[model samples]
Target: MSQSNLFIVMSIIAVISSQPVRGKDCVCELQNSESAFPESKLSRVEITALECIRNISSEKMTEVDRLVLGLQHRLQQLNENVSMLEKEDNGNLYGAVSLRIIQLELAEIQDLLDKLGTTNTNNQQLSTEMADQLRDMKYTIAELENFDHTMVVLKDQENQRIKRHLKLCEEELNATSPPPTPTMGNCGLGQMVNVSGAKTYSLTVYGTSYSFGAWGRDANPVPGDENKYWLVVLSSSNVFGHFVRQYNSLSTILLGIGPTDTHISSSNPTTNTIQGPNMVMYENALYYNCYNTLNVCKFNMTTRTVTNVALPNDAGFNNKFPFAHLASAYSHTDMDFAADESGVYVIYATTSNFGNVVISKVETSTPPVLSQTWSTTLHKKTVTNTFMVCGVLYATRYLDKDTEEIFYSFDTKTNTERYDWRIHIKKLQTNIKFLNYDPRDHLLYVYSDAYILTYEIMFR
Candidate 1:
């Protein structure tokens, strides 16, 4: 790679490192089978196996990419180390087996990285080249592991472990490429770099400071209410709490403050508490993830009646800490609810299943049912937040300290995902706990800390 390209890659690493606000004890734990992520409990696909394939492809690709990039960076450091050692010993380190192994690893990384840049579905040649590289790397690692003749014990042990890890990643990646059928969706060519925004004043709420986790605007015009918008905010609690605030575009005052009520009583006492910080307003009803439970709650705006509909067992929930609301560390939302022109939908990521995005169309009745379910290749963790515009699912990525980019999109109409588009938004704050795109007003609501920012979307 050119020096300029290396500089760009390093800059991206720096940005990613700074974006996540962690405690001093937090460290980047290796994401292997023995790490934080459990072995993926991918479920069998009865209708279409597209999501499964995509899950395997995307996860393996990400793992291999990260490992290869790290290898390249380490190789550079090793080269410098080798040069210094040579200087100290009058060029005696040239014949070191550890140095030779490092050289071999660097060569393999260079080849794999080159393949990664040009490999695509359309190009059979590039695809074959990548597959060959993976196989070669796997073979090379096995060879290095068997040869146990190294003078530098520490370097040999580290390099061997790294090679073994890389081999495992490469082998996993090799199994997913060149699927049985043709690729259905392709990522966009470039980043959606153009974004502009303004901080529309924050609403001053009366009473003690409450840490609100979920916030959404009911953009669809209510029959009796014209130009009147309904904003719903939920505190970070599982037992029972919520507020419905009314807003008019002309006035800055938020008039109505809730029918502050508790309808969280459930037959399953263990799952009675609400575990979600995500809620969506559809028609006149408010839909939210019923936390610590495998269900979604639909609260009637007029009647104030709440009904619960059980989600599929695979639908994951992340309500670990009781009474944990809007805490930054516990910010990973397992399930999300969204509304669009067609109707309301529930979105979630699952570990028991394929670890892909599962979206279900909600049927608004006494007890709502999922009319239809849609699956996508995109994983849930990679996305920070998701919202629908004209039935299209756009997901945001927490890219950097100063930016949050729209890196992926799913066309619900065709059940395809485009990964290439990266629409960059310059952020005033580092952490964006909640984001909701109001299609009716063409405004993106970003909630971080005590501020609520509104950004106008102008696509060219």
Candidate 2:
């Protein structure tokens, strides 16, 4: 070979060698890869999550079946008791008691039916069975009506039904049933307030009542102000209004902490910055998630300066919503700020963990830093509202006009998860936007669509 040809060949070989070997775009052929390294890809969290999914499906079906059976049994017993009373000579005396029992059982069964209807049962067989049971309940209810209508009773007995039923109804209607009463404690109906049926009270601050949304209460009562609670309410004008309340009063009197209309500094620096739904109060600082930016804003009441901390990119802060979702929205439950016994934490849904909650502990630094994080099994879509009681996270789902079921709860202290707490809030209507429990006053405040409702928590 010629020297020129040899030199050209050597140069080409060196150039090709210097260039990296690029492979074709490889698809993730997991099945093929598993055949090579079967045990290398397994993850602990994934395994745990799979097991949890399996257990939840199994346990939910079992629970639905058990609830249906219990309701059926109770209905059967009530029917028998009512029939026996109708057959006796002194039936009217017992008739009232039997009818009362029947009425109570009917309420319980109805509530269970509501729950069964709302539960997302993917199993076809279980869903069919639930439908059948619901039909059976309706039949039972019809039979009860027939029996009441056709029962042969003396004229005195006729009045006896009304009188006894009225008495029983009166006893049930009374909201004074103390917490220790066995029939009422775990009945899921928390103690009823003595005030009007409406649980709402106006926020009277600055000698004038002002309506605002997205509120936060001091973790503990303001220092030196014993019974007085320090509360901050966010207005649509990017302003934070401060208020204080005495121990027994529902009225929120303005404390004049910052400007009457203290504006929060937004990155846009415009008059039309967005407002968020949730906020938490710790020490003398207020922490809230800003709407568009998805940043946690810490507004110091003392310094009157606002600091913003950016959440993780995947923080699922519903930036899609144009305006503030004060009452309710289809996807308004992206993030919520809750203060437990330990400290304040921001609970938000994230895309990274596949529909799970990420709780980040917020330290009250200049630019509040996320201290620690905990993953939760709860999917944000399933819950309507969430609040932290003590150190436990409680989630609610809207069932009906009067019932908000506590469907899921996670206790951070014991590291325990509960699916069916069966604890419920029984109120007049179901327009509650947000509910916060103030431990100091033992009061659960409800923010409905238009008004605010307050209820006293009676402890046994």
Candidate 3:
């Protein structure tokens, strides 16, 4: 590539670095079968697969992810639909539509009669066809993976070429472009000569403490909600704080939308009508806890109607054994719930006679019914706490010269039933009056008395 072309690529890299919160495609190189993830057992080909992933563009990698999600959802729907045909033989209206597609219904009554002594529809035919369709789906999935790898390689080449050109152009502009001209509502943008920048738009969702500057008492809403995905703002009073909940129709959250305490009046529905409003947009339906009851539910944003999922009995909606008064008995510091890449977990204080601390987790995967509860007193500081990005948990507690608590990492993997312990404790920044986990990046952020302490986590 020309010297100018190389500079262009470097400028693009600078832009990528500017959005540091996005860790996707952060690895510059690929991993493969030979060099697969730090797994105990790996095929030789895994290194190449890792290499392919490392070499690709972040954009393409996300695209493939979206496609796979779409595919999985479609497959799930198909399976659910197919399962509905179960009661067809009885010919009841409950499954009337489904019955027509039932195994025996697929053939003529006369053909069924002539079949054999035991007309147990071999379905060997359908099985064969099912196998074929499965193969096709597998093929499509593989194609998507290959396409992701190919795109990554291509983008790297394009970026390397574009960087050289960008750098040269940037230098020339610095030397020749007229000094920046200031404009309204612009923050430091006019200072950058010719590199155009967009005006940052500020959308206030909630109020901050400075507004109420009303001293004596400040309350931060309890923010252990991984399912609802919330921002927990600590109050000036230190004892009281409430979480401001918002609707996240899209799984992805925007970055740098500074904390807002303004109340969001959702037009969708009332809280009393539904259980705990832990709203999560699942493809189409909005899944949540009904009035914070054991009955997990779903609401369609389009229809604004609650949906009843066919889950196990343990997912019952009532004053069940577990939730009858779990909150009341637990420390009053309202629990924060979070759903990682795996199932949902409750972050709360397991108030035993012993000193109260912060820690909670999910022991099972199925909905409505959880098999176990993992609780531990991770820190001695027991004032207030919340989970931030990059899987780090932060808390605020009394600080004695002899003892102080800061931040820690609990678990790393996405899905796990067994509590294979992986906890890291490192004494960190004090005076973090407030802390919030930004979904945009995996950074444990804290608002100390002064500037923001952005803790960059290094994952193994």
Candidate 4:
């Protein structure tokens, strides 16, 4: 054979002989999930990662299948349980969210997993072929004692091909992967309070684009007299806590997203703990509304952590069910809450017992741990939520006599007494849209898609 042809024959033999007999590293043992080598460049190590990523994808696919199976099994058992409930018991929101929301999420996950399974298998096959090709190339490069003209040209072409294939595989992997969708509620977002009586900072949360649409650090009365601010949100579905100033202008999120208390189950369940990124900071402590359970946890910013502050009022709360969600638009009858040196006051929802505008209060002063004062029925047509700015409660509630228009500020201090007199306050904004308290600025910020309005306290 010609000299060049003879070299090719020898290289092929060498490539074939180097195939492992045993005792090689098990690719599965060196898993990808251990730690990521994000900036690696070594071709062999990259190939190992490619292999490991495929395995990880396979494992995820298996998990997806398992979840799907569990969903199906749960659905069947739930049906049986439901039938028994109709016969001797009742139904609740446990399965309401499970059936409508959770099942749909499971199906979506399954679909992604199925696609990942197929893609992973294809990538695996492609990687194996590439590895074999690399082995052959190594053999071809063997015995390079001298510069051979044709062989140099062939190596250059092979290298170009390898680079192109590598790029294509990476693009494919990138294109098929899913992006994370963070579920951030308007936890401490919508409510307005001039935190710590400051005009430069706000105790607000960063909400998502789909929700409050505009997400940013809101202003609150910047902490003075050694107090702090916080932006609260639930962590990974199971955690509840707020973000606060760690040092200087830097911020850090604290609290493991755990249950409101022992009443919540160990099984991590999906939920909406806040309407927006809403949180309340007071007395060097942090309080949050588990909304549904109305569960509050007191956190110390100095210690950088929290402790469950179960008030006597919420002591009987089961934590088994979720609180009802407030709508996105303007509804006058929707009452929220705000707390100050006086007490914590909750605006009323149009519950049957509360009539229409239910203004409730819990005094922080010594005694029966926050009384449910004034559960009187609302005579109004429709009302939204409530928020307090400088001890004055602002409720966007429907006019009792005029349902067509939504009015602002059903002040507990003012509205608790005279009905006709308090409802006549000059309308803050005619078409009152979304409202939030900028505590740092002590201004009521109202926004719609088209308008951003700020109201300064003239008399508070």
Candidate 5:
């Protein structure tokens, strides 16, 4: 080879080596060993490679920015939805429906979050903000989901049943003469004004394994059973009870001694079994929600017979509108039984009334018919529990893990309701599965997470 050709070859090799090598692209033209290499071609190849890298980097950054902007817009919409939900939650008549919509929206947000997480980006601050917003929205969804509102999905059969019940209720109300104005009856304790803190707290005579149950004396006991204390430990799925354990007195229950168990059913979850943790002993019989049905069951402890009366088909049951709080829901607590000085009553919510509390007077007849029904404006989902005192329906809400606020009331006697009451009651546990006012002693009995707590009711 000529010396000049060798120098040209060496120069070509150096220029090729120095230029950036973009993946799988031709950076320089191949030439014969005797041909002179073009300097402009080499310069163009180097410039093209650098521009390619810059363009690729710019495109990636733009994509990241686009994702970030989309995420920000979605987060803004989510915040608005959350704010609207909070504003509309006061009555929350349609809370379950609203929550379902929110759930769908949350799923979309989650999908976007997942997409954002897969992207390669260097904007740590924007990424962190998005992550935080998604997390907070998820937490809100979790808290709302705890309401157990999934039962709001009414099957066709349920819808028909509810319509029929509504018709029956309407016909009954029209057919019968208006009921006499309710009176306070023998309740000498004027209108209930305040409820004292827990006067006593004791674990169940059974154990903590049964996390949900009820214990209280019969509000209207027969001659010899006045002092009888009945304990019902839900022995199946923390939602059904097959027996009642009777203690001779409060002292016996306190000492965890002498509970005579009476089986209400052969199996734990069979028919005629107690469906929920709410029940009340009144006049030698146990009143409760029947298993797998919307009927109130009356079990006469005396005869061992069960008689059930169907509630309005619109009634919420099977955890449709159970008492709930921010953290959890006590399942199957749709039908709450209470007894005031007047008679036994069943408190529940109905779909026709949009999940507002409905109070029905249970006539202690041969079959225990619902004689009169009163609807209240208080939303059942917002309340943790309800009880009756002197024909007044008192509703409670969760204040904290250790407290409950009796914030609203509806007087059946006057068909009037109040929401400004601030009566507070302390709790032994975070959740109260069952609470009822027993007029026998004017005391509030609370079944809280397998523990029993009692409070005194003070009147104005």
Candidate 6:
């Protein structure tokens, strides 16, 4: 070992020893060539980086929340729209418009769902809820689309039915003789000039809760049941009825005595039940609008059997052309069974006739065929009620709570119509749900707001 080398080695050892020993816990201070690095500057940079990351995360979350809230609001609106459509679905006539509206809303909802899915990709729970709501809305939209298709199919079927009926009507008219004209012998009462005030007024035996109903004596009664009176009180929201109450006489009904007989039309609304407030008792049978269909039903009191005949397919039903006024509309009152001196007639409105009044002569034979049909220029919705007297179809309109004016008339025998007749009929209530003429008694039986009223028809 040389002396200079040994001295160099000792100097290196001392320099290394003077640098200071460091433990695991000791922190080293770094420096640039000129000075030590600033601790405050490093701390500030770290804090700024953390704040930036936090701000970015918060902004993303806010966007996601906004999307979720918008989606929820849209879903709520869609649900309300569906509910409204269900409520206004009347015989599928207005379904097309409703379906279109629903489809548009569904499209908007789908767009919102897409936005939500894109904006909130990280939240699994929120994403799941949104997906579920979207799926439900899709299902609802599918149902509405199906309903639209069904309406189309049903319309097609109805068109076919109308063609068949038209052909049948032509054949029948050609086969039958010319309809009889109104004469003194056939109809002793001349033209209806006026209607007297209520001769008989009484609430229903079932109480005022009935609200809608009909009451009249049989126009063509059986030999022994000449004085028999029939009542049909609508139940179930004033839309459906399943029974016909009978009384031995007008005296009994006016006295509110318990019914002598009760005839069951059906156990449920699905079967052969009365649908509208308009009904008539002719001979030993009760004629009315059949349940949920455009048919005239003949329910025999003796046999307890129901027979129905489909009206003209163009005939409106299920409130399509219901009897309406400025204040309210009578639901399910499309088919009005009216008995006259001539025979049983059904008065209704038809779409083909531009919602005008249509009168059809219904033969009380097996299955009750429609023998003759007449279309009038009178709009059926404008009239509150109608009745047949001596082969004349008379329409009435509301004047006030206590009066109804006979403003229109259509003579089936002459095929003539008059619209300026202002024969006013006094009433006990504002709404007359049912008004029918009994040829046997020569009286007008009006069921008005759960009240049974009878009026005498004066002729000229």
By summed lDDT, the worst window of 10 consecutive residues in model 6 runs over 25-34
Query: After best superposition, candidate 5 residue 274: deviation in angstroms?
Result: 0.5
Residue 380, model 6, lDDT: 84
In candidate 3, what are the lDDT values of residues 1-460, reduced to their tens digit? Answer: 3346567767777887887765467434322323223232223235444554554445433333333433343344345446534423444543544434333333432342344312223434534655665565566545444434337766887899999999999898778767665231122111111100111111113343321101100111123322232332323232223223342211111222223233222422334233221223332333334443443444443355554433233332232211112112112223343433333344433335133333334333223334335434452323334442223333333233222233333333221122222323222333333333333233343333322333322222
Off by over 4 Å in 3: 1-206, 209-332, 339-343, 352-372, 379-383, 388-405, 409-440, 444-460
Which ten-residue region of model 4 has the weakest summed lDDT?
A: 247-256
Give every collision pair in model 2.
199-453, 200-452, 200-453
Error of 1 at 219 (Å): 3.2
Off by over 4 Å in 6: 1-186
* lDDT value, candidate 6, whole model: 0.77
Which lDDT tens digits does candidate 4 get at residues 1-460?
A: 3466667767766765676557654231211222333333345545655665665464453443444443444354346434433443225623453345345545654665576577567657866876776675465444231334347767887999999999999999878657764221122233221111111222223322212211112232234522222333233332332243321111111111111221122333223233232344455543444434543444454554444423334222222111222333332213344554344555443334433445456443222134554443444334443455544444455343222122344434334432232322223223333445544434444432222334433221
At residue 132, what lDDT does model 5 achieve? 61
For candidate 5, the 10 contiguous residues with the lowest summed lDDT are 145-154
Per-residue lDDT tens digits for candidate 1, residues 1-460, read 3456567767767877878766654343322222232122122221124433443464454444444444454465456545534544434533464456457656766765665655434245645655665565566555444433343555877899999999999998887656554222232222223344442435435322443454446756477544444444444442234455555321222223222333444332234344445677776677776645778888776776778888777666663211122323334367677776567878886655477787788887877888887788887766677776666778877767787788787776667778887678777766565667666655677655434566655432
lDDT score, residue 60, model 3? 39
lDDT of each: 0.58, 0.55, 0.34, 0.39, 0.79, 0.77
Error of 6 at 281 (Å): 0.9
lDDT of 6 by residue, 1-460 (tens): 3456567767766776777667633343433333343555445545655554554564465565555555565576467557756766368765676667669768877887887786656556555755665565566545444534237766887999999999999998789676876542236676665565565678877787889888888898889887677887777778988888887655457656448655564464767888989888887888889888988999998888889999878889999999999998999989888988777988899889999988899999868899898989999889899998888888899889978999888877678888889888877788888999888657788888888888877655
TM-score of 5: 0.60
RMSD of 4: 26.5
Best-performing candidate as measured by lDDT: 5
Worst 10 residues of 1 by lDDT: 38-47
